[model samples]
Target: MVRQDIPLPDGPVRTCIGCRRRAAKRELLRVTVGPDRDGRQTVVPDPASSAPGRGAHLHPTRECYDLAVRRKAFTRALRLTGGPSSAPVGDYLDSRHDDDRPHLATD
Candidate 1:
């Protein structure tokens, strides 16, 4: 195999599936579909963005999550055959919302 030493972009940017806003990669949370303990495919959060397969980015907030769900972004973004539940994402966001710290997305 051959490799080329090409210059890379200065910084990375990703768009939020919820807000549809482009922001720095670090500012968004990467989520990808994965199997739950039951072996069923489910939407899971990838805060570290290390998960395999296609992934979608979104701000970690309720409003964004809601918008994403309403618009069925997860289904299209992840390209799933059947609609996947947002429970995992909701639970993840809810857990973060319970925190007493500032968040990237407000409302």
Candidate 2:
């Protein structure tokens, strides 16, 4: 019988679209692009991280959000031809409170 030399990491790791840091999947928030009523693409938050589509992970902090926008990471991460507005994400983040941010502490 053959044995593997190295073992895989215990949990899944994903890169943050804003801070560009790799972290456990469960420690990040997932966002997906979906179509609105007008057929225009809109950024949607996947709090449960179970949305059925391509998703980008991000840290749930305003700092990360600003950095992501300034760096235009969303366009590349979300695979959009044009840079999508961050309003949807900003609004969503605004609705959240400090008490809701249990996994957002940075090292």
Scored by TM-score, the top model is: 1
Q: Give me the candidate number with maximum lDDT.
A: 1
Predictions in order: lDDT: 0.88, 0.81
| lDDT of model 1 at position 26 | 87
Per-residue CA lDDT of model 2 for 1-107, tens digit only, reads: 53486343469988899998777888888988877667788777888998897889899888988898899887788888876666788778877854575776587
In order of listing, the candidates' clash counts read: 0, 0
List clashing residue pairs in candidate 2: none
TM-scores of the candidates are 0.81, 0.76
Kindly give the stretch of ten consecutive residues in candidate 2 with the minimal lDDT sum: 1-10
RMSD (Å) of each candidate, 1 decimal: 8.0, 7.5
Give candidate 2's root-mean-square deviation (CA, Å): 7.5
Model 2, residue 7: distance off in Å is 14
